[model samples]
Target chain A: MESRALGTGLNLLAFSPAILIYVYTFPYFYANINLAVLVLIAVLPVVKLLVPKRYSSSVYPVALIIAMLLVIATLFYLINPSRYYYLEIFSIPLALSTFFAIDFAFAFIFIFEGLLSKRSSRMIGYLFLSLGTMLYELSIIAAMHEFSLTFMNALSLVFSLEILSYYELFVYGYQKFLPMANFQIQINQELLVLFIISTIAIVFSIYLRENGHQRERLGDLAYSLFAGSIMGTLLFAVYDYFSYTQYQLSIIGFGVLATFVAISRTSRKEKNRKPKIK
Target chain B: MIRKTGYIVLGIIAGGLLESLFIGYDYYIVALMILFFVAASDIISFNTGLSRSIRNVEVRREIESNSARKFQMRPIRIFFTNRTRKTVYFHYYDTLSDVFNTEGDFQGYIILKPGEQTKREYSIASIAIGKYKVGPVIIYAEDPMKLCISSYTAPVIDEMIVSPALSDIYTQRSERLSNMKFTYGIHYSQKIGQGYNFYGIRPYNESDDTKYIAWSRYGILNGEDIYIKQMEEERQIDVFFVVDYGIGMNQGTRQKRMYDFVIATVMNASYSIVKNHDGVGYIINSSKYDYFIPAKKSQEPIRKFEQTISEIRPNGDFSIFQTFSRIKRDVKKNALVFVITPFSYPESFRKGTRKEFETNKKVSLFILDPYDFMEKRKDDVYSALMKNSGLKHYRYLTALSKFFNSIGIKSSVSREKDLLYRIMAAYRYGKLTNEGA
Candidate 1:
């Protein structure tokens, strides 16, 4: 409890400057990619360090994303050397360098805690770290535009899915091992479909933005699509929680419709199979 | 194939319905493009010369590599051969077993060019112990139109056995401390100054040299000569552990609860006792005497001890008393006993366990509380119970602790809160005083 309170307080205090900066420079964020990336790369590790070390798996993807971003920036520089006159040749790369180093250090500690340590609290801490790392990596992709973006987006989508699957597994595991309470959530085929659609949409949005002529608009659209879908899902979850709404009603409806179709088709088959009574 | 088509159809329907609602034909156009692309790909993929050859393509791999021990990673190489003329893109899929849960970076597609023999190495670590089969390597070949996709499943599956890691006995603490005093013997032997009892002995044989000669008997019998037999002052303490191996015990992560903990505890105890020259540990579960190595004052015997514990399986009902009863007959001499369990049984059952425990007060029972090793965060039930009107949850600790106390078995509780620390603390307490209290 003390650690949590301290972490929250630290984050609040540390975030004040960033919040103030963003408030003063809201609309100019799109044009100031260099500044935004610098600020993000600088502040993320601080915020992460402040966020009480629970999520371990988050560090790897975050580091990988940072590395990929540097590579993208280098490619950008090579593609348009004269256009880069206004920007520092090594600024983005330097920021990314620090980002990788910091993320790696944190990840090493978290992974060690997860794998070697016998403490359950530490393991839980590592899980949270992993969750945070995924979010961080997503934010970075939301900021960048390049051909590699498609692959990164696909990876991030898969990573998020993996995290959710792992979370469900952990919850089930807790129930199975401790018998404290049952996990009520039953992930059905519809949810799987939804997941696939969301992932595909996200991947396509990224791919089109990077490879197509309208690359400039692609980044923002992709971000909005991701944000919108997640928000929609969150809204559903919140509504369900507060109203005790049975989301399963829709699933049941699907099942019943499926059954109706099956029976009707089966009777038709039976009709076809029967010899006409002469 | 049906699942894939259903997705494409659902996308089309959803797009078409939305297009109908809106006046623009853009949604319909997008929907049509998606459908056309999918259909086209399916047809092309199905008829492509590459995919046609893949239909009857038998891809076989003669795998030869060392499989890892349970919980450790090892690399295995697979040699693949495409027995057909055309190229096939193969992707391996396995019915993931409970034991294989390690994360590796090799689930993507691999394209095998025609008549090519390729070898790929992948590492697998088994989280649990059991037999596991690998592969129904799916080969996907599609035509240029990206139309019908054809895939083939390989007929052969490879099997691998994963064993557990073990430690050697000479390295055990007990034998090292004893300085090799007690030698390994198959049967019970009467050694002088080693036991409390004395038995008759009359031998002037070559085997019974001056080192073991009975001076008093020789003195009494005069020149004709004979020797007397005396019992050793102390003998090894034979420890027997009866582990629970029911379905209930398999509820936790990595399946078996008692099995994993027992292995760890047994290894630790065997290490400690074999270090203390006078102690020897033996384990029995089910009806089988799984490990019966009498303690020797040498480290070599500890290897056998470890291997036995590593091979322990979860079988039979969890009857603590039954296991104890069996142990009593097999263990001829006094030995310190340790019982590791997660007590979820009723008071009557515990009472019976206590009765068996009292039969040997020297027993040191370690109740490895399952809640400690495997914990779940539930609503605050204890506070609810105190609140009288709030929600309540089942707290297994308070009741379990009371039961242990009632039975006079020194019990320690381990929780997920600080499991290793708690265990270490309990072990320290155990070492501080032989009594659990």
Candidate 2:
């Protein structure tokens, strides 16, 4: 049994490179929709089902899908080095995707670096700030209609990507550093409405490509979108209500004020009595 | 509020930089909208946050029962209120008992306008036993544009208890075993009568019976005194102890002390059984967690058994019959079985719960009641009612002991700490009775 297990291990070692090569090439042979769906299905199963239960719990499957995108992006660069100057801007998408794909690694590394008092990721945050600027700049000067449309769509996609990064920063900063400041912020209804509206626009633009029909029927999807928005917004409202209302304002305020007046009164009494003591 | 405004300005600056890179001269509109959104959202969130801070927010956690042991899941309820005029928004993040080793992700927002209350309910999977501290509910809120996020951690603490596994270990009728000598020989009759070993005999006194005499010694002593070798016959006896590591045991700031006390009792009992050279074993039945090691002597197999005991963490779900069936396979010989558990779950810890406990074999059963000893004894009327309930449960245990005794199984009951003292009391009484005889 031991020998057979060892042989199987060796076989897996030999086949790993073959599997990597197939993963890189397979997506190219298929259309983007088919490729994306296929990658999603395959990656989800391998990470979720085939792996041991404990390891599966620790490793988020989202990271693998992101990694696959990074591999594809790297392969694209390798295949077309001559077009590097024209396509250098596309690297922003690749860089952001890599961060998403390897989030577990990034989380661990950040935790370690934070322990060591190194602020390298803060620098990366600044770099993302810079690249986001550059992408916005490129979106305007694109000469063709298709080019501008693609650029605008891509920028919107980047906006959605910022959700995870910002959320991570908020949690990390709140947990480690700004603990005393009571940093719980509630989600507002207006923000939820905005998110739903923006999501609908992106979905209609990407999925429902009938330009005139989509433009005319965009309002149809608004109510359901708003309904979805309220679910999260409602939870945020309660938290905000409790934190600000309960102890911080009324009870605490009156208590402090009463204490202050009493202290001042006692001090005045003491002053009046000081001559008698002398 | 100022911090929020600064972030909004920074966001606008970022948008402008993007605008310059993309539309160059014509990128002003998008930059302006992003700036406007950030500024408006921050202002709204800051004012709302400040206003809501003045209102009363009530957070609560409701467990199914204050007293529960391993294998039982606890339900948590959170209530949020907005007592102020302006509407408030917030998100809830719950942390569970440490045994779970993972934080639950339940981030969602609620909007509570003034004089309105919102509630959320979630069930947490209970994995381990001990006193579990339930909540200091943390709420995260941020301005609408995601510029500034604030989180307020609650300052409330709640606790729950998880019980331990029970073993069905009943010993047969035996002498009272005690550590010290007693004036009254209550336990002497039980152990004084017999054993398999032969000791040196003494000359027959006036009370010596003619039945226990040696003819040759009678002849050598000229019929004045007869001597016979004293022989001891072995008589099998049963004992029982029931241990509970239930939720009530899970009170107090430190959970380890309760758990340690229960474990120490089991170990000491097992050690006594081995030293006594009797067929001794114990049963650990708990409603909170499933762990049962049958009574067995200390030897090679017991090393593995000890390892199993060491590895057990307090858990809340247990099946007694299933555990018995598993432990049955390990015991091949006729030996005593001692039960140590908190009989909490009615369905699981009742009379029909374990077939092994009812088996018509030469097994002795003992139950050590942990709850009776560990749970806080209250003096109020409600506490008096609870105490009465405890007493009723004790009567039930004693009745169960009588049933086992009728079936040729020696059964006894004691608090965890008094187990060794009881055994020692029994042994001492037996010795004095033998000397008198």
Candidate 3:
């Protein structure tokens, strides 16, 4: 009970910045992903308590959708619909850079907590995910030339406060589902997910449909697809810094590089474990 | 091998393909970072020795008793210890055969933190009679992503026999026997001897040891021929079981077979006869295994009877006629021959069996039908037809029994459950009437 009360108190403390951001960016209040994240932090820890027992299974997804919609609608009630994207309404490149840099620095700690210790904390994973997302946002922003710092201070503060609130929420929310975490893994979820990615590889395989008529072999097509994905291990770190999201060649280049190294390492371990015949 | 991790690796490759498609959107890098994160998770965990830990997880099973009675429930306990420094969350499964029905969970996810030891328990009942094997505990570890798994099949297996409750069956047999009518205390056999009960008179023969000449008979004979009084000689009856061990005898489900009940009948009757100090013997013949024990009034034959039934896998061809022919020679004169069979034999079997043992006036034939001992068939047209055919077959066997009885051989056509009562009654009736012979 004490921990839950502390969690709710910390959550509200972090959520107070959203009210300030609303007031500071008033009259032309611009919506942003960080603002949506603020709404995400406000909603999750409270949904289970408010929702009735009968519809308990649908409560989390419903809360997430409601939070996203409310943040977007409230922030940009008077804005033009034509320019809705990941970038800020008063886009500032340096502020964006600092945000991503902090994320990149935190990601190493996240990896240590999850991978090395083998007790992958979900809160840390979400924090690392936020930084990778920051990297994603920076790539697009660098492509566009016009930049400003009009609403940077307010937005940056809101994002920092959003991160704090998320920590409080994730810690509290995940504990309730810790016993159910293994059960949450639908035994066939991996199969369906793998199928979708395999379909993408098949569609992008140039070797298979080379020049419409001259067919290349499946082995070669597979070779190119995998060779491309492996090139992706160092693919994201550089691709984002160059703002390659706006580049013409970046698609064919980076797409081929990251074909698949995930299957590569795990598959090797499996083969090593198999018993050899005498 | 059972928890195939190879498919999971294929799953991760598919994620990589989705990452490639994300190049159309700037978010493709986000997908790439996730793939990279999972790959590193797998590699680093392997390096940190989780793989070694999973292989070292130990499982041990302890069963209370090696043998259980049919329809009797027994508890099983399994101990698991995580010897590794890292915690493991793995699926624990204990494989059981179809004959066993478990009362508690046999497979589920279990958590064992570093150096933690725990035990799980479940109860199982064997619904049928036979020996059954259980276990070879399989535990497989997977990270939350399930990208890789380390499985260990523990080298643990135990076997137990599910036979009819022996003590209960004997107890029921004892209760049923005390109420049975005896045929004259059985120690006094009315034959011409110098024992107890008087027999009329016979002319004195060279081999006769005359304790006293009958004076009344001498007066009647007027000294023309010497006469001696005869007394009944004391004797006991010996029973030999001629059992069928053919493929035909093994009808019904794997658990409750026709031959299983036949063995029950033979065991009960043999026990009763042996208890009364009458020598009991048996002959079980088939192409696969042939065994015959001659009449002996002791506890040893009863023990052998049980051991053989438990071990015998009833298979191969058996001819009741041939077994009876063998019995005719193996059994002693005037000893009762008890034949238990499940075959709906041809006309020749009846003729041949009667020719072999009926003239000796000491044979009892029991024809057991499997359908009478097994569970009923399903409620469908095909089963209805089969049940009809079974009825006709049973009537034919009963008619055959009547023919054998008409010719002076004590015969019964029924199921294994009823054979015990019939065999016991036949033995007692044989003892009661043997005085005339």
Candidate 4:
């Protein structure tokens, strides 16, 4: 079989049994798999064919998009239970976790192919996409649980402040913009666990792919993924802290310090020495 | 950096507006965090510098010049040292002159660890005669992400002398030389001079050295009379290379220029003639520069001739006719002259040949076929232009060659590939034909 086909087949074989278990355990999920979900899944192959061959290798972004949309749709149904006949299935944390775990598996495959191909950009893009999708799912979870207005405001304020803080780190601005005061916000442990699991899966895939008997070794992929994951987790923590406590600049300030440490660790990965010329 | 940062700011604002309109503050916070993470990664990458680890760089060439008969593989080695604490990833390449036909890798990436040195080796073949400088190594350093790059040049220059490509044409050239009766064999000049062959006996004269007093002949003529043996003096021919360096002569690709072929032919011919103890000289004519080396029978003149030819660049503005017209008075009678040019200009061909013929010299009009040196046409408008110009040049060259043949002047058309054979043939034909003599 062609390498891409083999990769896809191997990936499906590795994760399909887990998905089957999830479907069998939750009989409601079978009924809840709506026309929209089926259509989205069917569109994956079509999108892959439409894109150029060079970009067809990574199918995770498409799967992740579908998963994110399903989670958001589920949250929307929770807001208005009458709007969705299968609203109870959407609200189940187990079902949501299962969907996220499947998305995480696809993300692992995406990163695996990227490392094997030596395309650093693809790996970085997958990381960013996963982080964004997970954060969006977190917000949906918070909204579904009927968080207070002050908590929602703090989440939004700290989110924007975090962006501005990172922007200030790279770009010089003429004037400084102060952040709003923070309010108490609670952490969603279930969502946090899912995000961490996905991050670990992505990193582990990179490590495993590098260790495979490939002609060229991508030793740096594991280290970069590890450092990027730490940075991502630290960013999540800072967002949580800023949302739960008073909106002091020190919240984002401490996050930047942690980011420096993560970056330093990433740089510590050993570089391959120049080989002797034959 | 500014562009990516601006896009992120714009995205944040758009996300903020969307959150305020429909989704609550929670959605906006999540969107901002995502953007912040991306921006933070980029910021960290931007601050990461590629350490100044390259402390020294050096390049060495194996063979300076190839022998006449075979192609010489010139091995080049590039050495660089990294002295910084961090690993440095950089790309480096060596600059080469057009005279070389390079094989193997000239440009490659190097991953240098802290306090380590590395060397890369490659080989190139000298395809033409020239003096060329082979380097000032260019190095480009990039971060692990390849986000930003820093470039530096190491001014490590080495000189390469690519002498004229020589082949085993000695036997063929000698055979051709032997076939020419005027050039070799029992040709009598009627002058008793320094020679190996006997001519006749003459009375001992005041100017005759005692060495030539033919003691046996004196004894045969009796003690009362002394006689000298007269030996036939071999005619020492002076070969002159009248090279046209006009702008029209530069009509070819950089790698296979007509001027280069002409130089190679002239250098090889000079080497052959000097090997046989004949005087060789050259006259280079261009609008900007004109040089003349008088004919002399020695190894020194041949060395100077080859050196001068190697340095000649094709940028002449003057016509070949004008150069010949000016040098007509200096050309001696009965001398062998090879007019090397790409007879592109018909007027120059007519006037130059007429001037050389008027000087009573044995002129061989060697036309370097420019169409042979021209690059092959691809399906393009520029290719059409080249095709049209090439056709016109071909027509002019054919007509010129016919005219020279009709007028009984020895002429031959040569391409860069078989220039040496054509030159030797022209020399043989010019020497054997006693038309001007």
Candidate 5:
């Protein structure tokens, strides 16, 4: 019973930042959805307390499914705005869905990291989940504005790819450190690409010179970075060609770099790793 | 501690720089202010020492150890009180030892108002017999934003002992042996008197009761006999359980050990003897410690005997012979001494039994078969080597048993799985043989 309460509290802590961000940046969106999210959050703990102890474990998954359904419905509503006649009532569901989607995402990430992982710390998990959610929201907003018929359609295509690729990146990052955030103020895309290529060259030369003795750490990092940069460049070039935009290419490049780093880091086996203290 | 909100603020500052350089918007300051407020609130909360205030607060834990049963769920309660003026988010986790099988619900979190007290309850069960420590409650405190998280370890720990489950041998044996005469207690004298059982006829004496005179026997003897009827006497028996707490006794898997089986057997026997209105005692010998409880009748002694056994660990360095030699002088003449051991050291065991026999003390050795108690591993080279070693040990145990039989000493080998049944059968056999003699 105590553990259940702790899990719930930690999940709430993870979800709060996302909700606060939504309310502050998008008040109009927040106004529509605040009631539903608040009620669900408040009622969840009460429902856990009121239910028979035998059925307590069922609460989390059930709440998660409900929140997912709300998000899906809101996405559908956003896709077709002209179909609903009762704008006020339709707006409520739309707001509620959007709120739950972001909230549930953070909560699930925290649960996965803290309870199910080999290590118990949730700090890395929180970082990736937060960044992923932010990127996802940014993609949605970018797609909402119709720059042109062809450009808008291309943005949607990129958004779908970002969802799949970034979600995978988040999962990988939760397991191990990917070193994606170098804290560079100005992201230089051409310079990053050149560095990745040069690093791959140097790593290949070292591998040949050392007979693959350093394959576990340095070799894996170089190969993954090289592969990820090429993929990111291809994706950004395709999107830019259709949408006629070049400014957002750096963001896409960074996202791809992070993804590949995560993939490479997760693939290597960590021998004699210590269990993380909570 | 700054969390993802800090990242958003940094992103906004970068976005503002980009907007000024390229697509300038007049109301960018409004967006910046909103992000700034969110980040500032988190930073302020962290800098204000919210976590420190929570650590300074006191916590108390309470649980009932006696109510816990072997292989049964028992509930434990913990209480946390917040004396600070600030409202705090608190999480507490109570660590459980491997001896218990429990669900992952022994921790909780709560937002306590100032001076608020809360009690949390969790359930746990003992899956094996042994003593366990459940404690050092880990406490975590943070503000609502979770910007600054601090943890404190409360040095409070509690110990719980799970005794083995008692068997029904006591009640069953007492009923079966009600007709037999037990000549161990002071209450019933063996001499014919006012006891229930009829002994035989004897010539009437001055002290003989008139009511006990067998008129029929006297008539059959043509009045020259003048005999009185004698009856068997009932008496209390003193039972001493001599336990060997050696390292070898600790053999076997984590779920079941030879020492565990030995403790269970001794506890069951003690319960049966004490239940039958007899005095019970114990002689526990370990490497660093030795405990001796003289045989005494009553409920308090039985409880103490169980408590002591539950806390005992296997650490004996001295051989069985040395342990017995030290406690041999304390054994009463007519008292029934039960030596419960795995007989890991055969030579020491033989020597100890011989010494006890020489002293004329009625001793029975209940040997736990170590081979049977050992863990059966999966098919591997290590397991095969262990199997070969076990076979050799079994051969030695057989030889020891035969030696005891030839020397006219009572002994029995009990498997770990059927320890209780074997102990009961041995006790019944011993009673039957003593009665027959």
Candidate 6:
């Protein structure tokens, strides 16, 4: 029972950065309405966690799809929130559910990978999942600075959780004793690294703005929140590097080559993989 | 077919078109970059995966024996080799004949690398006789993320036959019979014959041979009547087994019937009589074919016997008498005839035995009860909850037995436990008591 509580706590911790960034998008949403939407966003996931997967898995996906469709409809119709307050409120969860949907997909992979327990096959599964999941973030790009930061947050968390959970280290009591070939599992100091990386990024972004990179009223608060969401989402590639020693040689994949590879997003050729059996 | 990844990609394209139409060119660049990423990573992997079809996976199935004893466990091994240079992951299921009960797994998931070989092994046993066709393995090769699928069925089936097992029952019984144990029914009474093995002395009768009179006992008796020396006959017992098969005896099946027990019983008896130098042969009366082997002493007839009984011939007979009369010429004059039938038509049995008796041929009847083999029992010796049909068969057979007694033909209804014992004993008594005549 206590382990179950710890597992849920870690889960909440895992989702916190996206929540902070999502709630940040809506400081302009009006105070009482912002509070109402925040409660709704926060409470829905908690309710999902409390309910059984048989009930919750179907409910969340259906709700997420409907919200996504409605938000798209609002965009096409130009639903002016001053005229239609409900449409405005609906858009709030839509922004946050972008995080919800991607996280939900990973949740499936985490559980399924453990059951399958074959590393190369899992890598094969994740290769497609990571590539497919990135499309949602790319599709949501709205020319807003907030969307850019939120996109980074979602992508980072997807890969980070992928790294942490792949080795069976994410679940509270689960162990990685199952026989798998060519699977390199390393210790992850992610929360610590995420804290340091976010601190450095916030200061760096502030310095860039001071040096006149700023074209908008992007303040210290926005930079800090965006940095926090970044820690929540992207370039934990250092964390990624440290966590998988075999992938460390790809550090030679740093600088121009690494940038090209990450930006171009090509498939990596891994050698001497263990044969997978079901 | 559109894979899961394909659906996600299409959804992205739709979102890209809508966002570019409504919002601006700002997020358009990001969507393009992501789209380019998807095209690069996925299409390359997808193309390579699609090229390696599941047909390239070779499967070989092996069983140690072409024939297994009934209810004996046999191990089966299946080796899977990837003939293609590419690694392939697939789910395989080896379909087994329903008569078999698998002792371990026969189906699971596995991945084979280029030129890699792996084998899965399991054991299965059948409480049945005759041939079992075990496999034509079904395989589905799935791409890494289950993004694409291909299936192939390997035509890898093999057949194994199961025949009834005859243990050392014959060896033990034949040895004891040769030692002259008077083991017919429960009667332990000894019989006198003309051969050389000495038996106890008996009072001389008018028919006693004068050369066999006991002189020492006569001297001791002095003025008393003469006594004669009796001897145990060492002659081969000629036994002919008439095994009934047809709708009357059993519904057609190779095993799990009273007929299978009768086959086992006859095989045991024939083998025992052969060990004792007795001439033994059988006639299987099926619907369209009558498998007949003439009485002979050596094991040469046993091989033919095995081959005949191994086949699933549908037995045909108008009556037990027809089977008896059909092969009566092959039956030795003094051969004790053993007829094994379910006696479904009791009148047919009565008529059959009456015809044989008129010809002055001594015969033994074994009325098989199909109910004894069909019912499941918790305790070893007792019958299970007796069904009404079973009761009717039992009552009818019991009445028929009494009628056989009235007509002077000695017979017993077959029960599984005592059936072999009874046949062995009847052959012994028939040989001991009738060898001289």
Best by DockQ: 4
TM-score, candidate 4, is 0.56
**Candidate 6: tens digits of C-alpha lDDT, residues B361-400:** 5677887776766646576444534566688888888777
Question: DockQ values for all predictions?
Answer: 0.01, 0.01, 0.03, 0.06, 0.02, 0.02
CA displacement after TM-score superposition, residue B429 of candidate 1 (Å): 12
Question: Candidate 4, residues B1-437: lDDT per residue as tens digits?
Answer: 22332233334433432332122233233333443444345335533545334433333334434332224677777777776776666778887776667787678888777777787788877665555667767776543333333455666667665555545223225545542432344233444577777877788888888888877766565666888877766565677888887777766675666666676567667766666566777888777668778888765665676666565556656575565564576766456777877755655434334434454566777777777777885769878888799787777777777777666667776667777667666555544443222
**Docking quality tier of model 5:** incorrect
* lDDT score for residue B370 of model 2: 45
Residues A39-100 of candidate 1 have per-residue lDDT tens digits of 55445445555555776357546766875876677767767878875444543554543444
lDDT of 3 at B9: 36
Instruction: Write one digit per residue (lDDT tens) for candidate 3, span A43-109.
Output: 4434544678777568657865764665565445436545554434433233443343433333323
Cα lDDT listed for each candidate: 0.43, 0.42, 0.54, 0.53, 0.53, 0.53
Candidate 6 ranges with C-alpha deviation above 4 Å: A1-278, B1-52, B68-76, B98-106, B122-129, B141-151, B163-235, B245-260, B307-322, B329-334, B343-361, B375-389, B399-411, B432-437
For residue B279, give model 5's deviation from the true position in Å: 4.7
TM-score of candidate 6 against the unseen true structure: 0.46
TM-score winner among the candidates?
Answer: 4
Q: How many clashing pairs in candidate 6?
A: 8
lDDT of 4 by residue, A1-278 (tens): 12544434333333332233233223322333343444545456557767899888676576777567767777877788787757666443435435544444443344344333332234434334433333333343333344443433644554565566446534642113223112221343333343344333433332333213221223433344445555545655565555423343345446546754654554453333332221
By lDDT, is 4 or 6 better? 4
Write one digit per residue (lDDT tens) for candidate 2, span A18-47: 223233323322221233333443354345
lDDT, residue B316, model 5: 60
Q: What is the DockQ of candidate 6?
A: 0.02
